[model samples]
Target chain A: MVNKAPLLEIKNLRVHYKVYGGVLKVLDGVNLTVYPGEKVGLVGETGCGKTTTMKTALAILPVPPGVVVGGEILYKGRNLLAMSPRQLSNVRGREMTMIFQDPMAALNPVFNVEQQFTPVLKHAAKNHLSNKEIHAQAVLALQDVALADPERLLQAYPIQLSGGMRQRVCIGMALATRPQLLIADEPGTALDVTIQAQVLRLLNNLVDRLNTSIILITHSLGVVYETVDRLYVMYAGNIVEVAPTRKLFSNPLHPYSQGLMDAVPKLSGGGISQGISGRIPDYSHPPAGCRFHTRCSHVMEICRHQKPPEFEVEEGHKVACYLYGPKNQEAAV
Target chain B: MSEAILEVRDLKKHFVVDHIGTFRRQPVTVRAVDGISFDLQAGETLGLVGESGSGKSTIAYILAGMYRPTQGRIHFRGLDLFSENGKRPLFLKKEIQIVFQDPGSSLNPRRTIAQNLAVPLQIHKPDKNIMRETLRLLELVDLPAIYMYKYPNMLSGGEKQIVAIARALATDPSFMILDEPTSALDVSVQGKVINLLMRLQSDLDLTYLFITHDLSLMRNIATRVAIMYLGKICEISKGSEFFQNPQHPYTQMLLSSIPVVSKDEEKLKPAKMIPTGEIPSPVNIPPGCSFNTRCPKKMDVCFEIDPDFVEISRQHFARCHLFGQTQKQG
Candidate 1:
């Protein structure tokens, strides 16, 4: 799997959202690569730039307010950040698609599901699809999500469906394209655990069947652990750690990553877990060196003045922390 | 263990859904909280967990006296809670409080923390010094009294929730209905809130009907847990045994569906038996055994007759026909 050429590579991606007072440095410098048929989870608390990173890479990040200060988002060797609006449109839906948390809000309330599926069908198809073909494709997509009655559902508006059904419908539209890459931004936030399980299982099955490279962006540790093969932990603009899901969960090297693991309420009957102390750093006036140093338990003098260097501790596992010194240093030690 | 402080029996809340079409309309019934029975003991936290449309929130509302139950009897301290006899006794009103899900919307943005706290204090304890009492409530929740002057908009989401809790405590209620109190908070912030809540409960000897969809959270905090499905209590068990050995098929599914922190733990996975189906609309609940349509263990009896809420084991109750086998032995 590591031998395969990467489908998506976010190299030193930096983003800043200009607010009223000053520029909020949303994403400092994120580096991630997704290979074919890979399930990668991006996790962080709210305001940690997970959404911004995805939007920027997908060329959907609203500009003017959202400015990519540096770095490149290379999708299949082509730089996504450098693409023009017209050029980017070619890859937007067909090559990649993103589903949001809110299904009703993502969908057109006034139009029926059939009408809503029209644009996706048009954009996703390379050449052309007849009205009948489009309708059949939409039905097939809905059926793929295990919808009970796709035909009747296609005729109904977003309001007619339940919350879980609406999300499935959105999933139907997002996947109607057979997208090479699927970016699910907190897709399971609104659904119950059962429905969420269904969604994850569907995604898992679809990925295997279609070889779709997925970047699942969510805050749920369990969702990330179960669905993703590898995961990246983001904190205040930077990706703090990246490792295989099992390894990361079992032994997270980064202090912030460990903090996140500790915060999760476990059903295994452990006492109430202690959350990390201190507030989330203000992005507008982020700390000088490591943004997390303000809250880091084992902060050093160098962590205050200089950024902690990235350390490749294991194969496919990387961490940005002073505790590990720097890349290749641990091996020498 | 302890005398039940609040006893709810055969609770039902139905709302009429008007299906509007250009030409015609049809009236439908949405059975939000139907035939739910549970008892809240003194100084105990009863975690009520269910997905949306499961009537968990509706139960909270009915408990708060916000919505009158279509049918049911709620006994609080051996008195009918919502009787037509009067606008509830002041003591009953003052003894129970509710903290809503969204702390942002629950707290008035225009009002200062002091002003918000004053409203409850003014109504419940007219003779108490408003400013002094507001500060005291803040301190009890581990917040500095300095936050009293700040508006809800200025505070963080967690802080706003703390302020909301402080307001709920202004009346010094024995029972509090916290509806997903920490759902809106960040993971780290959620822990702080949970710790604050636990400390407050122990210090003040408060009873809480904690309504949340977070099962892991319910395991850590609840003394007893009641699982809900389609407005019915499916399983009620001690928190210790609830997750360790879930009886109902739905509960098993719900528990299994919870994403485990590690793939190494195979037991964390849900039983791979239940079919994936959307929770049927409350407006059109199934005829018999509301869960029969999607239940993996559903039988002919389940389709024809609803299962009785039976105790399959000591202090563990489940509403399922499969439990009947154990019920016979028990």
Candidate 2:
């Protein structure tokens, strides 16, 4: 896996949203990578720019309000940001696709399943396939997601389907293109726990069988712990920690990561945790240096003034915190 | 043991909806709460756990007197709730207060925190100093008195929920119904709220009918846990036993399916029970067992007859043919 070239590489991605008072610096020099057939989890709370990063990667971020100040979203060694409209469209649904948190919003309420599938299928196939061929593929996709009756579902509207079924249809539609990479932003968050578990299992199986890479964005630590191999912990628009799922859980280096892990209520009975104190920083005037320094427990003087560089704590485990830097080590000694 | 603070017996709530798509305009009955029974002891948190459309919210509404039950009876401290008339007595209403999910909507956006808190205080404690009481409520929830002047929109999601909790506390009720209280908040914020609720439970000696879909959360907070499926209780047990020895197949399935953070927690989970199908519609629930369509260990009898609640242990009860038949044979 280390030797393999990354399927998607986001380098120094800086995104800003033009708001009323000032430009909200949503993504401040964010960096992430997804290797082929790798399951990566981007975990963060609300307004932490996890969704913004993914939306930017897919070129779906609404412009005028959203402006990419600086970034390079590289897919297969080619920069996605530099791609023309036609080129991006050709690569969008066919090569890489996204599934949103709300399936209802992603799907058209007026259109039946068949009508919804036709355009996506046609787009994926580059308009080469006939209507009948697309219909057959749609049925197969629906079956793959374990939706019982493909014929009945294809004729039904989005409103008619249950939340779980609607999500399944969305998953089926997203995977129908057989994209190399899939970005699922809280795909099962809206569904019930039982239904969420089922959907997640189905997603895992489908992605595994297809040998496709996935970037699962969710706030639930448990969900990420089970699904992803590697995790990128984002806090206030910065990738604060990046490590293997097990390693991150076992020995989290960053204060925010540790706080996040401790925040979740565990099933193995323990008293409720004292959750991280303070809210996410105001993005419009995000704290300088370490954005997490405002809430971090181990806040050094230099941390307040200087942005901490990503330090490799161990092999494949990186943390962006001054506590792990040379200054802290010398002080400790 | 202290007397049960609240008792529900054979409680049922059904809603009749117009079948719009069909040729004939026929109404379909959605059996939201189908003959569920439970007893909430004083100062004990009874966690009502279930999935969406499982009628957990309907049960909460019924208990809070927001909706009348289609059938059955509810007794609060030995006094029958429905014995009087359509309107609950003002004193009874004061005894039962509820905190709802989505505090953003629950707290009136137009009203300031002080005003919101004053509504319950003014209603329940009309003679008390409203200003002083509002500040006290704020202090109770760990928020500063300065926040009393702030509008709901000015406060964060967690702060708003705290305000809602304070409002619920305003009535000085012994029984509180928390309907998915912290589900809408962030994970980091959830802990603070849960800790506050737990602290308040001990401080106030409050009996909570906690309703939520997250079973893992109930493990830490609840004294007793009840699993609801399609408006019926499938299993009920002490909190420790609910996690350690989940009896019903549906319970086992729900337990196994929960995604745990650590391998140690994973080890404690029941063996993976892959649920087969999605939850059936409440309007068209399966003939026999509601969970039969999804239960992996379902037997032939599960499809033919609804099993009775078998007392698995001293206090643990499971409604499943697997246990029902075992008890019969024994």
Candidate 3:
């Protein structure tokens, strides 16, 4: 997989939000990459900038408050940050699409399914397809998501459908354009376990069949474990660990990653593990060195003075913690 | 065995809603909690697991005395809860406390942590020093006493939830109804809250009706587990037994469907059983077994006859046609 060029590459992306008192530095040099047809998981807690990274990549971050301090979002070797509005529009919905956490909020309540689908299909078709063609394609897309009655669903309002059904419709609409990359932000987090399982399975199958690369942003490790091939563990405004899904779960290098893994309640009965104690840092005045230094159990003197760089632990696994740095490696030897 | 702390007999909660049909608006009954019974032993966490609109919250509300049951008998420590009531006695209300799902709304925004905790303390134990009790409650939940001066808006989501828990503890209740308490919090904070709850349960010997949709979390914390479908429980068993040997088809489906984090956990899970369809609306629940519409192991009899609860093993009960028929034959 490393031999092929990345489908989407975000390089040293930094984002800040303007607030009443000062600037909130939300994303601090976040680096991520998604290879063609690869399923990547972006795991993080709330306010960790996982959503900010994706929203910035799509060039959709609201600019009055949001400012990209420095970054380049490269898609197919072209920088999206450099693209014009006209050019970006042509690429946005047709080449890359996104689905939000709440299906109800993602969909327009007043508009019926067909009305929503028409614009998306027309956008993909560049206003060339006829109304009948758009209608048929919408049905096919809904069917692709395994919705039982596509024709019936196309006429129904968003409120009429259940949470699971509305999510399925959103997925169908995102996939309708046949984008090369899909960013799903907590797609099944709002649904029940049973329905979530169904929707996730459907997503996995659809993405595999279409050979589309995907970035699944969620806080649940279990969701990512079943879906994504690779995982990126994000902390407050930075990527803390990156590895294959199994490798990361089996042997997490970063203390934060390990804490996150231990935090999830396991099915096999045991006492609930001790979670991380401290809260996420205030973004306006984040810690100078490691943002996690306040909470990290294995904090070192060097960690207090300098930020740790991503050190390759194995072929694909990399961790950004002082414990995994060369100094620790030398001390261990 | 210890005496049952709470006993619910044939509990039911129904709501009438106007169904807007093609021409006329007609009233329809939503059988939210339809004829369910369970016993909560002293110092046990009975994890009530269910999907949305499955009436888990409704059960929580009824137990917390927020919603009166339509037809049921609730006995708290051998006293009928609804029998003599003009309103539930102050003692009864004090004995049973509730912690809601979202702390953001549960805690009063304008009030400080001290003031929030003071409400229960002042009402329940007016003799006690309010300041001392509030600080003690904060210490109980592992929060700093200094936080007592801070408003709900100042605390983080997890901290707010801790404050909520502390407020619930202010009454010194014997039974607590935790309705999806950690669901609204982050994973990291969720673990913290769960640990605190577990510690409190052991230290105080409190019985809990821990309600949540996440079964994996239930596997660790709950002493016993119950699976609720549309308004009714399909299965109930010991936590270990519930995971190892789920009897009802819906239970199996739910167990199989939960996404596990590890390969070993994946291996222990039941064989994947994809349910046929979505949960039917409560207003239009199927005629016989409510789960028949989505049950993978559904038979013709399931569509026609509602199965009664049959004891599968010691303290393990399931309501399903497959088990009912087997129990009858044996």
Candidate 4:
């Protein structure tokens, strides 16, 4: 079934960082498309450039050490990469927002919740709203997030609230503007099991009502399993697979995706799970062909020399392994 | 039951915070670990599961001799841990060791892997060959012999934790307390650490008090699981039974909340059990049942009367009013 154009589209995103004397190829030829009101999860291990992918697409990458060597980040058919800083700033708070993993770190220690939230609300303000009007808006937003005593909570500093509460406050601040898209990076990772459940549900609920699309980046397969509709499996700065959440969990196509699924211990009291054997290769001197070929169990002769193209095995499902498509269609490899 | 390797009775560790603020200067009594008791049998893994404020970590700290309990008795093979002595008996200290959560902070960054291992070996087994023992420890954790010369910063998070575990085992402790060992690790690397820990447990015949917030982790590693909520063990059951048929409402919520790979995770909506908002501060825990504030099955009596522990089935116990009362005394 064909749908309208994606709300956000990224094509051939290549982000590089200058480390010491040489340039490090962080994100290489990444592609992602997110439709409006859809939930997409970006799952990867540490140093896989999940954060870099999001930051670069959002035009928020720090440029001295980092450089978007090549890429096209399109929002509503407009290229965000080419947008000026002033135009990008306008798009950030109102059009898109982000909720960090650590809410305490995102908030200021000395300032109360009121002071920290004002700047964000101001960016989202359509007209000249008074402090009282903004306070009312903040309280309503806080109440929407199921926080009790909104006025009283506003007077307190970030340190006084619990980790879950701090995150909820951050979520409230993010959704208060009613942005079209929200980017959450490990939003529930710092929370406890029960609290993580609360935060995720709240996020899902708030976004559902507002019809806000989400780009959730997390390492937990379980988090991605329950939360997102679709997800991208990343390895060493390369997106190995992209499929519907349920489909990926049941039958993960890529070898790295399967390895990651096998690594986490299950809750069903099963026998031990096997960990992926090798460490991720150094990105500075990344291996040729598939980034995960070194750790992949079904490594092929062609996999060592040629980079696999993202081949569509089924409708809406794409995999980068040479196990399908190019190797089958060409036979020359 | 097998002879209890370690026993804790009414363990309480309450810290009074002296408030220096101008408005409220009264010292607040934070009930970090309030009246909790559990026993660890030889060669068995007892998993203590809880959130941050649930005081599970505090119990680990007390057992490790990091903090002195305000009231309670911890018997290590029938020896009182808090005997008014500034120092613990060397035998007791050497026999019981604890591994902390953050391997990076727990390990000395300045020292090489060999130097770190040698510290414990020199203190307890000076007569033995230190370098040889260090090399053996490194091999046991699956690290190469070359890693002995490298520092902690050079190793990965999973490798660093493996080294931390090796250092903990240097003195050959029979009883070990693992405090959130794998929580900080990545999913794939976390599996390696858990596998190494299990192999070590069997090889050494060690008794463990494995504490973590990851309830799913207990399904494989823990022989017996103990669910802690607000400084109390809500339920203690075999790992298989614990997930199959959890007794406490709190345990059920935690289990259902786990993000499993299967679509079963979708069935467990957060609205099903877990209450909204953060865990109440330990400084002001609720009266009656600490969890009644959030318990979906909370009744009128739950607000006024606290529940006592009772064995519901063989090898399974729950601390909830749901099972009906036995007596006023626990």
Best by DockQ: 3
How many residue pairs in model 2 have overlapping backbones? Answer: 0
Give the TM-score comparing model 3 with the true structure, all chains together: 0.98
- Return whichever of 1 and 3 wins on DockQ: 3
**Where's the lowest-lDDT run of ten residues in candidate 4 chain B?**
B263-272
lDDT string for model 4 (A1-333, tens) is 147779889898999999897889899889988999999999999889999999887777899689988979999999999999888888898889999989999889999998878888888885578899889998999999999999999999999998989999999999999999999999999888888988898999889999999999999888888889999998888888999998988889898888888887776556567688778887788999888888988888888998999999888789998888665658755
TM-score of 1: 0.95
**Which regions of candidate 1 fall more than 4 Å away from where they truly are?**
A326-333, B19-27, B263-265, B268-270, B325-330
Better of 2 and 3 by DockQ: 3
CAPRI grade, predicted model 4: medium
Rank order (by lDDT, best first): 3, 2, 1, 4
Evaluate model 1: give its lDDT.
0.88
After superposition, which runs of candidate 2 have C-alpha atoms over 4 Å from their true positions? B19-26
TM-scores, each model vs. reference:
0.95, 0.98, 0.98, 0.95
Q: Candidate 2: which pairs clash?
A: none
How would you encode candidate 1's per-residue C-alpha lDDT over A1-333 as one tens digit per residue? 878999999999889988788999888899989998899999999989999999898887898899999999889999988888878989999889999998989999999999999888987775498899999999999998888888999999989888888888888788888889999999988788888888778767877788889999999998888789999999998999999998999999999999899898887757666688777788888998988999988897888998876788899899999788753355558
* Cα shift from native, residue B86, model 2 (Å): 3.0
lDDT of 4 at A313: 85
Local distance difference test values of all predictions, in order? 0.88, 0.92, 0.92, 0.87
